[model samples]
Target: MTGLSAAAGLGRTSALAVACARDLARHAAEHPGLFPARPFDAGFFHSLGLVGAFGSPWATAGELRAVNRAALWVFAVDLQVDHVAKSREEVAALVGDCLAVAAGDAPRGPLTQCLASLRDDLGADPRWRDQLERMLAAMLKEWDWRESGATPGLEEYLRNADSCGSAFVNLSHWLATGDQWTLANLDLVRAADDEVQRYLRLLNDLTTYDREARWGDANALTLGAGRAEVTERMARHARTAAELIDPLRETSPRTALYLERQVGFNTGFYGVSDYWGEL
Candidate 1:
C-alpha cells in the first residue's frame, strides 16, 4: 500500500477506537460497581477500544460492540473473583449469578446485569453461553487453586486458559459480526481461538508476574515455570494457532484475519503496556 493509504488506514482505526471508547465508557458508567475507577480508568477504556478496533480494523464501532463489551465483562469478572470476593462462597455466588443471567434469569446485580445486556445483544448463540461457562469455570478453578495454595502443573495451568477470556471475546465477536461461513465453521475457528488464548495466557503471565505476585493471583511463573519455559510454550501454541487458522482463510477469511491480528497486536502491545490501570 502507498504511504497515503497506510496513513488513511491508521486514521480510520483511530477514529473507530475513539468511538469504541465512548461506547465502553457509557457501559462502564451504567455499571459503576463492576468497573471501579482505580483499575478501569480512562486508559483501560482507550486500550480496550484499540484492541477491538485494531483486531478487526474492517469493523465499525457498532460491529465491534459485542467483542468490546465481552472484553470489558471479562475484566469485571476478574476484578470480582480476584479482588472483591472475600470468601469462596462469595465467589461461588458471583459465578452462580452470572450463569443464571446467561441462562435467561433476571440479573441480580451489576455484574449479572452487564452480562445479561451482553447476552441479549448477541442474539441467540448457544456457543456464547458455552464459552462463557468455560471462562467462569476456569476462573473458579484458579480461585480454588489460590485459596488452597495449590501449584498446578504447567500443562494444567495452560489447559485452564479460558480464564484468559480471549476465546470468549472472540466468540462474541464472531457471533456479532461474522459472515455465514464464519458462523458455520465456529467450531474450527474456536479450536484456533483456544490455542491463541493459551498463548495469550502465557504472554500475560510473562509480563504481569510481579503484579500477579503482589495481588496474590495465580500465574504460570508463580507456579514455578521459568520465563524460558513460558516463552517456549507461547511459541509452541502460537505455531499451533497458526496451523489451525490457516485452513479458515479460504472459507472464513475475516475470521482468520481477526485471529491473526489478535496474536500480532498483543505480541507488540503487551511488550510495552497492558490494558489495566494502576491498582
Candidate 2:
C-alpha cells in the first residue's frame, strides 16, 4: 500500500476513536451526578465495541485487547471525574496507565496485536503515529491537573478535548490527500452519514425523559439541544470522512470489514435504549 493508503486506514480508526470520545463526553455531561455514584460498569464488551469500531478485526487480537484495556482506563477517568474526586496520585496512575498502553510499552495482548498489525500495514507512515503520540501527550498533560483534584484551565481542557477530535481529523486529512485511497472504495462517507442519523435518533430517545419530567425541563432544554448540535457536527465530519474512505474500501477489504463491524458495535452497545431502557 502507498503511504496515503496506510494513512487512510489510520484515519478511519481515528474517526471511530473520536466518536467514542464524543459519546463518553456526552454521557458524562448528561449524567454527571449518576456516573460518580454508580461507577460506570457498562461492561468490558460494551467498551470493546467502541474499540472494535475504530480499530479493525484484522488487527491481531492483542491489539484489540490493548485497545479495550486502554479504553477502560480512559472511560474510568471520565466516570470517576465527579465521583471519587481523585487525588493527584490516583489521577497520575490513570494517566500513566493510558500512556503506557498507547505507547506500546504495556504488555502485548489481543488489542496490542491488532495495533501492531495496523502499524505494520502503515509502514513508514509517520503521520498516524505522530498524531497518536500528540494525542497521548495532550492527555497526559491534562491528567497532570486532574491529579490535583483541580480541573485543567478551560483552554487546556479544551485543547485536550480537541485531541480527541483531531484523532479523526488526521484520518480524514490522510484520506483526502492520499493517492491510493479514495472515497469510492472506503464507503467511509456513507458509513459516517449512517452514524450521524443513528446518533440523532439515539440522543432523542435517550433524553425523552428529561423532556417530560417535572425537573427535567432544564436538562431537556439545554442538554437535549446541545446534543442535537453535537450530533449535527459529527454528521458533517462523518460525511467528510466518508468522502475520504469510500474510495479506498474496495482496495482494503479487511479495513472495510473492520469499519462495518465497528458501526454495528457502536449501535448495538451504546445505543441509548440499551443503557436507558427504564428511562
Candidate 3:
C-alpha cells in the first residue's frame, strides 16, 4: 500500500513532459547532427515513458528533473555504444570525453555535454562523477566483447549488465526524495543488485534478445539461450528477487517499496514495448 502509483507519478509530472518536449525540440533544431531527430525527437522520447519509471512520489519538481535527466543520460550512453559507434577507438574517445568533463574539463560533444550539464546542475558531486566513470567502463566492456567476437559467460554478462547504471540511477532517487539517502556508500548497492537488479537485467535480456542479436551485441539471451531458456532464467531471478524483497519489507520498508515499484515498472514497461527490436 505504501508504493506510489506509477501512472499517478507521471500525471503529477505532466509539466516535466511538456518541458522535455519543448527542450528536446529546440535542441534538435539547434544541434542538427548531434541531437539527430530519431532518438532525440519528441515522439521517441515520449514513447520512452521515462517519466513514470523514474518519477518518485516524494520528489520535488527540481529533484525529479535531476534524477530523470540523469536516467536519460545513461540510456544515451547505451545507445551510442551499443548500436551506433563502430570502432573501439570511437567508443574509447567518447568515454574519455565524458570522464574528462566529469573530472571538470569542458565537454566536447553532445554526450559529454549531457554529462557536464547533469553534474553541474546536480552540484558536481564526486559520487555522480564516479557513476559516470563506472557506467562508461562497463559499457566499454561490451565493445571489448564484441570486438573479440567471443561469447561472454553468464556470470560475466550479468556482471557487466548490472553496471548499466540502473542501480546508480535507482540509488539517486534517494536524493530526489529529500536526500533521504546519498550515493556516498556504494557498498550497500550489492543488496540492491542481489535481487531487484538481478531480476531487471534478466528481464531486459528476455525482452531484447532478438533485437540485440540483430545488432550483434551481447544480451543475457545471446549466450546460447533460446526464448524458453531466457524466460526460464527470468523466472528464477524473480524468485530470488522476491526473497530479497522480504527482508527489505521489515527493515527499510520505504526502500523495499521502491524496489518493488521498480520491478513492477520494468515488468510492465518491457512487456509491451518492442522499441529495441529490429522488426
Candidate 4:
C-alpha cells in the first residue's frame, strides 16, 4: 500500500482495537469469575487509563474513550490466543468465525457481531482489508504452532506487536489531526505528535514487558531449553521497535518533552507501581 493508504489502514485497525477493548471490558465486567486471578479484567481497564493519560490532546473525550476500549480488546485477544491453544479446536473455530466475519459475512451471535464490527471498521481500506485477512491467516498459523506444541518464534511475536502498535499510532494521529493533513491546525498537530510519541513509548514498554513475561512462560513450558534464545530474540525485537519510533519522536521534539513530563507526573500519582503499593 502507498504511505497514505497504509496510514489510513493503520487508523482503521486502531479503531477496531478501540472497539474490541470496549467489548472485552464489558464482557469481563459482566462475567468476573471467568477470568484468571491476576486481575486480567482490571488490568485491561487500567490500560485504558494509561492510554487516556498519555493520549493526544486534540482527541475528543469520546474518541479517547473509544481508544481505551480498543486497547482492552487487543489485550483480550492476545490472552485468549495464548491460553486458548489448550483447546485448539474451539479456538480455531473462533478464529475461523472471526475470519468469516471479516470477509463480509454476518456473524452468528452478538459477540461475533461485535468482533465483526471491529474488523469491518478497521478494514475500511481495501488494502487494510487484505492486510487484516493476512493477519488472520498468520494468527491461524500461530495457532497451528500451538496445536503442534511449537513455541512461538520471536519474529512472529514481534510482527504482531508492530501491527498492533502501528494501528494505535495511526488512530492517535487521526484523533489529533482529523482527516485533513495540510489543513490540520498547528495546535492539533502539535498535540497529536506529542500524544502519539507518549503512546509509542508506553506501548513499546508494554510489548517488551509482555514478551519478556511470555519468554519466561515459554522457558517453563519448554523445560528451559528455549529461554536464552527467546530472550535474545525478544530483545532484538524491542530494539527494532525502538528504532522505528525514534523518527516519530523526532517529529515533535517539544511535544515529546512535554509528554515526558506529563507521563512522569501521571505515573507518580496513578501508575501501576503506585497502585501496587496501595494494594
RMSD vs true structure, all candidates:
0.8, 12.3, 3.9, 10.8
Candidate 3 positional error at 243, Å = 4.3
Per-model TM-score, in order, reads 0.98, 0.42, 0.79, 0.52
The full ranking of all candidates by TM-score, starting with the best, is: 1, 3, 4, 2
Instruction: Name the better of 3 and 4 by TM-score.
Output: 3
lDDT of 3 by residue, 32-117 (tens): 55555555655555533354334344444444555565666676677788767878988998888888887889988777777777
Residue 194 of model 4, lDDT score: 33
lDDT score at residue 15, model 4, on the 0-100 scale = 60
- Across 142-214, the per-residue lDDT of candidate 2 in tens digits comes to 4454344444332333334423322333243333332354334334543443343333333433345453343
Write down the lDDT that model 4 would get.
0.46
- Model 4 stretches with alpha carbons more than 4 Å out: 1-39, 84-86, 119-123, 151-279
Clash pairs, model 1 backbone = none
TM-score of candidate 3 against the unseen true structure:
0.79
Compare the candidates by TM-score and give the number of the best one: 1
What TM-score does model 2 achieve against the real structure?
0.42
lDDT (C-alpha, whole model) for all candidates: 0.92, 0.42, 0.64, 0.46
Per-residue accuracy of model 4 over 6-73 as CA lDDT, tens digit each: 88765764564455445556655654433443536454454455444344433444555434544544
**76, model 2: CA deviation in Å?**
3.9
